[model samples]
Target: GADVVHAHGLHAAARTALALSGRSVPLVMTWHTRRYAEGARRQILHLLERRAVRAAAVVLAPSSDLVDRARLRGARDARLAPAAAPSPRSSQAPHEGKVRAELGAVERPLLVAVGSLVPHHGFGTLLDAARVWRALDPVPLVVVAGEGRDRSALQQRIRDEELPVRLVGSRDDAGELIAAADLAVLPSRWEGRSLLAQEALRLGVPLVATEVGGVPELVGEAAELVPFGNGEALARAVVRLLGDPERCAWLAEAGREQAAGWPTEDDTIAHVLSVYDELAQPSPHPR
Candidate 1:
């Protein structure tokens, strides 16, 4: 029999709770991200999320924002447990010239945004900002990495509006692409210690991100932040950063310093194992 059951995400927690009904095993749940749905579907998920959090002996979340969310959802014991970024695949240098040439951004300010092309990821907002970037001295090239259901709609809009943006679908070398760009943009509506942000910072690339969820806490003063869904603000921030070489250099150094403070994979494992050990201890008062 299992001593403790650990579940990740809302659906997994719900399923685990149902399976462990009337059992004595303690449930530990890790809340990752909020499910973005609308109307009845959103309501159903809210109820399920509440039930799952309430059932868990302890809930773990990657950021303080998520920990607060879990507590508000009825989790009795919620704690911050940030997930570590995966180590780089190889030490090989990023092909900056090759990536710039392929994207047709050889003489332009190359901007990169990487994530699933979904509504909540805010690709639409980035496209709107791209429209603003069009009036710059040398039009910037915006390339997005990743594919999703919104690809068709986004592509259609890009073609019709003639926005200087390209949806590059999915790429295995997203990190390399990020490193090659002049600026990395994260226009997410919400995020929890974003992996793209981590990777960008770790690579010493300057970043412009939406100030939502755990982003402010994660990047601190290292990256420029704009309000979520504000295309104009995002565009302005990007323009300001690009025009100031000194500021950009400072931000690059700051980004590297910030990333160095994040928890390592081994640290994450040790923290998780400690939680398990604490919960697995025998009861002091036997009934």
Candidate 2:
């Protein structure tokens, strides 16, 4: 009775219905991420992934890397359909004043990072960079705007090391915080085309982020890149950007231009609909 089955990942919940529903339906799977595993568990997952790829009518990946991986896993039709960020027009609200005031209205350089307090987010590296940033004559404020289980641990490190960093916990107005900053940073150890990076670029905020996952592809020449987990590199990138206002301005302008060319949510939906129209056609042979 179903026209098609749309799945979002290689996980059980995403693929189970397509694999076991015992019905003939066009299946579309969107590959968002892949997890690390080992031993028999890894083999099991690999096998399941192969089966899922074989069963899917089409696989949509957010980046070329994911599309390549899907094809390697035996997906019949894998295509690139990069994820879209919120339109810049909608995010133009000016809450920057309120956001800066909440952070003691700091007059010095302000760096913003927006992600949960997770280890893989590489926030510990940011803390180390903050220490380096603080040794300067006018210390900068590093504001992280997200919450997670590692909150206590990060807070403890800040207190013990006397680092110039503050965790603002979860924030609904994260775009405002990014807008209030002199720069944005994403020290992720791994990522799948970070939404934060997209948002930062779209908002015309210069960024210093780790060169991991699809970040290089996402930012193009619009931002500075640093190696993952290298606090020294992260700090140096920040210093370079902060010292050069002209370069920062160029990056901000370039980021906005690049982000403008990126596909929007409506584009993604239209692409999906196009695929559906193709797959929904009746075959020459009747079932």
Candidate 3:
């Protein structure tokens, strides 16, 4: 009954007690993007974004680059309010052997990714990577999780590529695969936050992600970052990591270290409380 709103993400909106209509109140908006265009309009969207932030009580962004971008857009006072990273301990990472058996992965090196099967996620690029991996003596099996409107198109692509990929469909057990897989990949066009990538890192798993959005800010050295939408680069990273267990182990440990900073539910709650407190503080009369 007594609280102020703290908004997060592109669709979030916060309503605070501060008023301009002294009745309309001020908003605290959290911008979660850095290097992506906003609308279909071929115009000054970035500048428009700053004007929107200027109307807010406080401008909070998940990454420093986002803050800088917001400033560049012309927000006089934008700050970083990073998202809470989830802890690996609470993650339901399943036993690799059990999951492998369940998924019939004993015969192949499983290269898997779990996310919305859309153009932005680069399902096509993943297919290309699989093609490269298959050129080797023993090919890797690609299993994809997630369901989207583009399923039919992607299936056609698989047929065209003649790749050994099985669409596992929307899954509730991605944690099992994340633990079982020989490789975890996130080939995306954009990501203000990659919770999928975070899950892999939490399980002390290695990742092959493209350099995009706020992912680099989150993963640090935990992942092998390649250029966006580059099939060759994606395949190279996947093959290199899959071929070398010693390097994979190093990457796994590095992921664990980076994942150590992941914020849990507790952190989210505390941050909300802090924002409410900040909003509730009475404003001093201007001289």
Candidate 3's TM-score reads 0.85
Whole-model Cα lDDT of every candidate shown, in order: 0.92, 0.85, 0.75
- Name the best candidate (by TM-score): 1
Off by over 4 Å in 1: none
Q: Write the per-residue lDDT of candidate 1 for residues 107-192, one digit (tens) a residue.
A: 98999999998999999999899899989989999999999999999999999999999999899988888989999999998999
lDDT of 3 by residue, 1-287 (tens): 33344555433432232233244344667786543454664256554464566666677877677787767766666776657765445665567878877777787788779888777888888888788877875778888989998789889988887888888899878777887888788998877668778878877778989898788988997899999889999999988887899989998998888888866678766775687677877678633
Highest lDDT: give the candidate number: 1
lDDT of 2 by residue, 1-287 (tens): 66766787887424655455676778888878766567999899888778777778898877777788889988899998857877555545667776777886467788899998878899999998988998875788889999998999999999999998989999887878888898999999877778789888887899999988778888999999999999999999999988999999999999999898888888888999888888888988996
Show pairs that collide, candidate 3.
19-22, 85-262, 85-263
TM-score of each: 0.98, 0.89, 0.85
* RMSD of candidates 1 onward, in order: 1.0, 2.5, 3.3
Candidate 1 or 2, higher TM-score?
1
Off by over 4 Å in 2: 12-14, 17-21, 37-48, 88-95, 284-287
